[model samples]
Target chain A: MDVLSLPFIQHAILAGILASVACGIIGSLVVVNRSVFLAGGIAHAAYGGVGLAFFLSLPPLPCIIGFSLFMALIMAAFTVERRHRMDTFIGVLWAVGMATGIILIDLSPGYNVDLMSFLFGSILTVPVSDIKVMAAVDILIIGAMCGFYKEFLAMSYDMEFARVRGLPVRLFHFLFMALVALAVVMTIRVVGLILVMALFTIAPYLTERFSASLAGMMVTSTIANIVFVFTGLWISYRYNLTSGATIILVAALFFMIFIILSRFASCPRKP
Target chain B: MAPGGDQQTTVLPEGQSRAGEVPDVEIENCSFAFNSVPVLRDVNIRIYHGDFVAIIGPNGGGKTTLVKLMLGLLKPQKGRVRLLGSDPAKSCRRVGYMPQYSTGEKGFPITVMDVALLGRLGLTGIGCRFTREDREAALGALRLVGMEKYMNKRIGDLSGGQIQRTLLARALISNPEVLFLDEPMASIDIDGQSMLFDLLGELNKKMTILFVTHDVGLLSRYIKSIICVNETVYFHHEPKISPDMASLMMGTGEKCPVEMVAHGIPHRVLGRHERD
Candidate 1:
C-alpha cells in the first residue's frame, strides 16, 4: 500500500494500464491477421528509432514512431506485393534494424545511455512525458478501432473477399501495419522492444478460443493484459525483479496453464 | 446441350432479357504474369448477364488467377478487364466472390453470423454498426446455405464443408448480380455438392454465376458455358467437354480441331487431379 502511494509506482501502474490498451486492441488484430511475425519485426526494428533518437539528440518517442512507421510501410509493401518472399524480407529488416541500432548507439559519443532499459524496459522509471505519449497512443488506437472495426474484421478474416467487396484491402493492410508500429513503440515503454511481442500476442492467443468475435477477443485480451500487468507488477515489486520480464512471464504462465488445461479438457475419456 | 459443337447460341433463361446487351463481365486481351512467368496471355472473355460459367483447368494453369483478375484482386500485366460494364475495382461492390476455402489463421475469432454480416460491408457506411435489417439478411443468407443452426458457432470450429457453406453465405448475402466462386466444391461431400449446385441453379435465374473448379464431372444442368484455362483462355459455349478438349485442358494436347457433340447428363472422361 505504501508502494502504491509512491509517485513512481503510480506512474508505472498507469504506464502498464495504458500499454495494455494498445496491447489488447492491436494485439487482437495482430493475432487474428496472423501477423505476429510482422509485428515482431516492427518491434525489433523500432530499436533503430531509439538509437537514432539518442544519436541525433532528438526525442525518442517521435523518432521511434517515425522510424517504426517507415519499417512498417516497407514490410506492408513486401507483404502485399511479394508475399512468398515476405518472411525473408522481414528477417533481413529485423537483423538490419537491430544492427543499425547497436551501431548508432555505439557511435554516439559521451551519451552513456542505458541500453538495457530499451531492451528490457524501465517501467519503474517511465517518465510522466512517456506516460502522456502512451495515453495519446491509446486514444488513437481506440479511435481507429471504433471507426474501422468492421472493415478490419472483414479484412482480417478473408482479405480477398474484403477486396471483392471493395473494402480497400491494401489500404487497410498498410493502415494496420502503421498501427502495429505505433503499438510496438508504445509497448516498448512497458515491456521493452525485446519482450513486446509477448505482450502483443499471448493475451490475444489465449482469448481467441473463447471469443466468438474479433471485438470480443480484443476486449477480453485487453482485460487479460491488464490482469497480467497488475499481477506482474505486484510480483516484481515484491521480489525486486525485472518488471518487463516479470510481466511477460506472468502472461506465459497463464498461456501454459490454459493450454495444458484445454488439452486435458479436450482429451477423450473412456466410458 | 452439346459438347465441342459450334459455339452454342446464347439461351436466356425465362424472364431474363439482358443477354447480348452490355456484357456483365468483359476482359479484352488481358495478359497477366508472375515473376516474368506468364499465367494468362491475351485472355479475352465476354460473359453475358444470367450466364452460368465454369472456369476449369489444371493446377498452376491459372484457374484461380483468372477469377482473381475478374475480381480485381490482381491486375493484368496487359489488357482491360470490365465487370458489370465498369472496371472491376470500381464495380466490385456489385459482384460476389467466394475465394477457394483456405485454412487461414487457425482459430481466427469470427462467428458464422459475423462472417455472413461481412457481406453487407460494402453496402454499409464505414464506422456504422450492422443494422437489424443487416442481421436479418445475414440470417436469411445463412438459412440459404443451411448454416442457420450454426450462426453462433465460431468459424474455426466448423467442418470443412460447413466453412465453405458459411463463405458461400457471405458471398450471397450482398445479392450481387454476378457471383464468382473459386474451388468452392473442393471440401463439400457429393450430396452437399449436388445440393449446392441446385441452390446455384435457383440463383442463376437472377444472377450470373462464374465458379472455378477442378471437378468438371460435376458440371450440372445450370452451367451454360465452360472456360478452359491453361496459360491461355478458351471459351467453350457448351457445358460438356470432349476428350480432346479435356486433354487440351489437361495441357497434354495441341488445340483440337474437331467439334464432337455429346448431349445430356454431363460427364467427364478425365480423372480427378490433385487440387492446389
Candidate 2:
C-alpha cells in the first residue's frame, strides 16, 4: 500500500491517465480511419528526432516532437494517394527512421544513453516534468477531438462523402497527423516506441466490439487503457518484471479474450 | 414509419422546373484522365431541377468519374462543372452524396444514428457540436428511411439492405437540393432494389436526384431520363431506351442488348431502335 504513496508510483499512474486520453481518443480515429500503419511509421520514425537531439546536444522531447510531426506529414502525403501501397511505403520509412536513430546515437560522442529505456519505456521512473508534458498533450488531443468530432466522424466513415460535403478534409487530415505525432512523442516515456502502438490500438480495437459510437469507443478505450496500465504497473512492481512489456502483454491478452468472446456473442443482424 | 407524413418535405419554390431557372447540374466540355488515360472526354450534360436521372455505363467507363466531377471530388482536365449554378466545389455543401455501399467498413462500431448524422456535417460546421435542430433533422431522415428503430443500433449489426438505407438517411439528412448516388444498387437484392428505387422516387418529387447504376432495365420506372456514359456522354431525354441505344451505350460487343424490363411499367417501353 505504501507503493501507492511513493511519488514515482503516483506520477506513473497520473501519466497513464493522461496518456490514455490521447490513446483512447486519437486511437479510435486511427483505427477506424485505417491509419494504424501510418501511425506506426511515425512512432518508429520519431526515433530519428531523438537521435538528432542527442547528437546536437538539444532537448530530446521538443526535437523528437518536431521531427515526428514532420515525418507524420510526409506519411500523410504518401497515404493520401496510392493507399493500396501505403503499408509498403510506411514500412520503408519505419526501417529508415529507426536505422537513422541508431546510427546517430552511435555517432554521438561520449553519450552513453540508456537506449533500452527509450525503446521499451521506464514509466516507473518518469519525472514530474514529463508528466506535465503528457498532461498538455492530453489537453491538445481532447480539444482537437471535441472541436472536430463531426469532421473526423464523417471522414473516417466515408471520405468521399465528406469531400462532397465540403468538410475541408485535407486541412483536418494535416492537423490530425500533427496531433498523432504529438501523442506518439508524449507517450514515449510511458510505453516507449516499441510498445506504443500496442497501447494505441489494443484498447480501441477491444472497445470497438461493444461501442456503438465514436465518442463511446473513445471513452471506453480510455478506461480500458488506464486499467491495462495500472494492472501492468502492479504486476511489474510485485514481480520485478519489465513494466512496458508487462503492460503490452496485458493488453494483448485482453485483446485476444475480446476477440474470442466476440465470436461466441450473438451474430449481428445482417441487412 | 410514416415519416413523410409527419415531416413535410422542404419545398424550394424555385427548384420545381428546369425552364427559366439555373440548372441543378451543368457540365460543359468537361474532360478527365488518370495518368494520361482519358476516362471522360468532352462530357456535356445539364440536369434540371426535380429530375430523377440515372447514369448508366460499363465497369470502367467513367461513370464514377463523371459523378465525381459533378460532386467536385475530381477536377476535369478541361472545361467546367457547375452545381446549383456555381462551381461544384463552391456549392458542395448544399448537395448530398450516397457513395456505393462497398465504401463502408462493415466491422466499424459506429451507430446508425451517428452515420446518419454525419450527413449534417456540411450544415453544422466542422469541429462543432450538432445543434438540436441538426439532431432533429437527422432523426427525421432516419424516420424517412424507416430505420428510426435501428438508430441506436450499431451499424455493424445491420443487414446489407439496412446499411444501404442508413446510408441513404445520412445522405438525406442534409436536405440537399441535389442528391448524387453512386451505385446504390450494387449489393441489394431485387426486392430491396425496387424498394430503394421507390424511396428514391418519393424523394425525387422534392429534389433533383442523380444515381449511377449498371442495372438499366429495372430503373426506367424510377428515372425521368438517362445519361449514358462510356468514355463519352449522351443524355436521353426520355425514359424509354431502345435496345440499339442500350447496346450502343453499353458497348459490350453484343449485337442485341439484354432487355429485362420490369413487367408493370407499360407506359414506358424499350424495343429495337429501328432507325439506328
Instruction: Please name the candidate that would achieve the greatest lDDT relative to the true structure.
Output: 1
Q: Model 2, A242: alpha-carbon shift in Å?
A: 1.3
Q: Name model 1 segments beyond 4 Å from true.
A: A269-271, B1-20, B251-276
Question: Which 10-residue span in candidate 2 chain B carries the lowest summed lDDT?
Answer: B1-10
Give me the displacement of residue A238 in model 1, in angstroms. 1.4
Task: Show where candidate 2 strays beyond 4 Å.
Answer: A81-84, A266-271, B1-21, B189-192, B249-269, B272-276
- Provide DockQ values for all models, in the order shown: 0.64, 0.64
Clashing pairs in 2: A147-B127, A270-B159, A271-B158, A271-B159, A271-B160
Backbone clashes in model 1, listed as residue pairs: none
C-alpha positional error of residue A232 in candidate 2 after TM-score superposition, expressed in Å: 1.1
Model 2 chain A weakest lDDT span, ten residues long: A262-271
TM-score of 2: 0.90
What TM-score applies to chain A of candidate 1? 0.96
